[model samples]
Target: MGDGPVTRETTKSAADDIRVDQWAGGVRRITITRPTLRNAYRSQTAVEIAAAIEQFTADDADQVLVITGAGGAFCAGGDLTSSYESTHADAVQLGHGVVIREGMHRVMRALALCDKPVIAMISGPAVAGGLALALACDLRIGDDTARLGDTSGMVGLLPDEGGAWLFPRAMGTDHALRMLWGCELYDAQQALELGLLTQVVPAAELESAVLALATRITRTAPLTTRVVKRMVRNAMSQSLHASLIEAEYAVAAINDTADVREGIAAFLDKRTPRFVGR
Candidate 1:
């Protein structure tokens, strides 16, 4: 959808190598394009992902975001082949080496902190760090072929990059521990059963399913949607009373937005409101 002439501001840059294309209507798609490595996040790719997500958050043109992979594989894990070798076993050697960089941590944090509602469209294997990235989104829609799990333990490392925190809340603590410690892989139905995926569809329907969800979400008042999302996030770390107060303030803030006035006017006129995401 970003098919127009590339201006200095709109031209793709090195820091935004992770492709982010904005659809003019109100949706943005961020695709992890390194399919040759099963879309694994390494130093540069992770940084690019964070930068792209930051760009999406700053853009008022879109109200919904869909994150997906570019090819058959969604993501495998960290780029272990590049990160380690038998000779680099010792901490001293590993610390001095640039191979095992920690750029993915910044990427994970950016995904979690972005205010836009993110939908993960998983079409293939999304294991280890990939699953962690999917879980950070507001919703996950996976194809029947998709696999979700943390494979960190299999590679002799504990789960990092928000996996340890998100899984405990998403699935129960016991389920999270079982998946982590046992290194069990979960298919689409298993993931849905465990509350990991919001919906599971055939591979051909995966992208359409996520877009449908995005469409419905965009039909709501954007300001209120963000406010409710923020309040729910605050409730995770704050007291119930505090969360209620936060929600109250958020509602007050959304009341000042143009979308709210348009919504009211449309309802009075018995017509659909065209929210500008203002």
Candidate 2:
């Protein structure tokens, strides 16, 4: 961020104890760093992940976020050794209490709530909560070597972390139930066939593909993109008339932005608009 000294001092910490690397051209890559543990998510890691995403939203220099894992695994799921040892099923009522499941919810909410698009680039295994994380992203591009599954049933736990909500919405109810109940792993091609992945690129081309998508997204007017995103989301819960009203308001707002002016001028001149993300 090229913010002045005051803004620099006030900026939130991008990542804490997580391997978060920010590129110069508005792309931030967040890697779960604990490869020895296969990137199992801990409570602190979840909080840090949320904080990192919040940082990305506040920083005008960054427009896209790509989340992946280190050491060839996206995530092995929740840190089972830690959670299982601590949580007692008998202590909690049937969904009446907090259930101490806030970590997963917070992580999922952070990604889903972000205004900008998120892309998950997967190359290796994603099981249980790990698969849920990838599913939470707006788009997923995987390599041939990737694997995805919900292994919670195998370990005697119901799928958590918005998996139950997101999976049914992504894949049909029957397919989601089958994967969760059967606890089977699907390879990249199978995942693609099942509509879990947007595209399957070679392992070597994964990074480039993700970057290209980010570049394409950032080339548009930033405010227009944000409004269009909201309109699409609103359509899910509201009536078409309400959605159209929102879209009209958004278009009016976008027309007032400097990027819209540049876009109009560029179109008349038969040239590409160099958007400044205004």
Residues forming the 10-long window of minimal summed lDDT in candidate 1? 1-10
CA lDDT, candidate 2, residue 134: 92
How well is each residue in 1-278 modelled by candidate 2, as lDDT tens digits? 12221211222355543667764366777878778888888777777777888777777777778888878788878787765424566643444135335567777877777888788888788888888889888889998889998888876777767888888887889999999989989999999998888899888888777777876787887777777777777687898899888878887878888998999999999999988877
lDDT of 1 by residue, 126-178 (tens): 88878888888899999999988887897677676678888888899999999
Output the lDDT of residue 51, model 2: 81
Per-model C-alpha RMSD: 3.8, 4.8
Model 1 residue 214 distance off true place after TM-score fit, in angstroms: 1.5
Q: In model 1, which runs have C-alpha deviations exceeding 4 angstroms?
A: 1-17, 84-87, 90-102
